[model samples]
Target: MDAIDLASLLCSRLCHDLLSPVGALNNGIELLADEQDPDMRERCMELLSESARASANKLKFFRLAFGAGGGFGDEIDTREARTALEGLYGADKRIDLGWMVTDEKMAKGAVKLLLNLGMIAGDALVRGGRLDVGAEQRDGALEMVIRAEGPRILLDPKLREVIAQGHSGGEVEPRAAGAWLAHSLASQAGGSIQLNDPADEVLLIGVTLPN
Candidate 1:
């Protein structure tokens, strides 16, 4: 597929994710306007605030992981990427985050791969779990590892296939957008991405990027 096609797929994925929060925001606004009861109005306001926060967090993450992120820099601060992940997953308070990335900086593409991989792993924790993300730079290369542990984890079969083999041979879908994006970035950089297996207790996503 060409750049436009890939972009379209990613956009579709983003829209799918944001639709819920945006719809909730709209619904909350409508309810607030029609409600006369103080308690009901207060609940609507809370819903609006929550929807707004969720929308903002997802936007921030997509900007960094897929957009220009308001810069032309080749490298971005690792902390910025971690904060984006925190906003995306940790803010919900369902998934506990364990950040072990000690590096001060990383290539922008590398950071995108890291973020997308972490997002995928964290999402696999179907029931609420712990996600540990770690990265290190050594000998002119960067290594990233993400582990998700929980009572139950389910990585979709299609996503696992895309992550393990790539989408070169099959049609890319919106649900596989993140995995495809990560694989594309890694391929461009001559790096590697290791996917998860159904037998494993903890889902692991590993990557290595040249420096």
Candidate 2:
């Protein structure tokens, strides 16, 4: 409900995600310093590169997801959102993305909703299945849909509740910050976020914002 709390939560979430890759960077540097074997040295360098890339990807994704990206404007290029998401999950090579957006420009808050909702749905794909992100104008409203399907899907009960409805005055946590933000933004725009009842293999997230 407050900007300060939301900022702190998002910061914690970013730090939590970056920890592994950044820690890998440190370990890789230490290994490189101690290794003398040519093959081991090469492996260390490779590890360093991989860790750096991972760290960069996470930052890029967060920049768009949680920050006022590129400017102070109310709208942003939709392609940027797609690229940010692809950067975040593309390297893993597990989940396949099906981007079905046709709009060139979208309200910044709308794009943020899509990005965060996509992140939550994608996380549910424990086995890294398919993620389909689609958005368009319908009946003078902007509709965003994100569907995640995999062999096994696991969604946190609290997250499911928070995304579709709200915290209901409950305490906020770092992991749910994105979903919470999406919900808040949608409400501010006189819109609502929704979630389909989880099936055996699929989870669906949807949002609609006023024009």
Candidate 3:
């Protein structure tokens, strides 16, 4: 990937992840300014604490996956990666994780690719569902598949566009930011994303990474 494109992608990712907790912090401050009750103040403090922790964990995970320390030429720390994934999704027991591949270090690009795919799968499951994430080495390349199965699948059209084209410069009519980011990351990693739109149920995302 070109340096300029890579920089833009990283900036986009940073802005996207930081917005949530930072917005929560702002809301907490506003509540503190208007509320005088002791109990309410305690609740606001708790909100702030939770938001801070969530933001920190996200940054830690992104840093390892997107930063220079982790890359194609370097070995990823599998333990750290698993811990980060758990931090991101383990809080809710709704989504059961099925790992088909061995716990081994992967390329940094592969790590980011898989994480983004997982995020997409999670988004498809609005009412909670099962996510099966697996990786395999095939034909001198690495292939990753994320299967999301739920009673109802919420497929955003804008996200479908991003996954198919790799870029979209328009108003955010829906929650397609995550899909756009996933497309950018996949393009940078010399990979492509394929979605299976079954007529009945389940949304499957397939990503292939060049080794």
Lowest lDDT sum, 10 consecutive residues, model 1, at 63-72
Candidate order (TM-score): 2, 1, 3
Q: Against the hidden reference, what TM-scores do the models get?
A: 0.95, 0.96, 0.73
> Between the candidate structures 2 and 3, which one is better when assessed by TM-score?
2
Looking at candidate 2, the ten consecutive residues that score lowest on lDDT are 193-202
- lDDT per residue for candidate 1 within 1-211, as digits (tens), equals 8778779888998999899999999999999889999999999999999999999999988888878667739888988898889999988899999999987888788888988888888889989899999999878888889999999999998888878677866688887888888888988989998866689888988888887
Overall lDDT per candidate, in order of appearance? 0.87, 0.88, 0.72
Residue lDDT tens for model 2, 33-123:
9999999999999999999999998998899899887773878888888888998877888999999987998888888889999999888
Cα distance off (Å), candidate 3, residue 81: 2.7
lDDT of 3 by residue, 56-78 (tens): 87787667655665343566755
Residue 64 of model 3, lDDT score: 60
The order by descending lDDT is 2, 1, 3
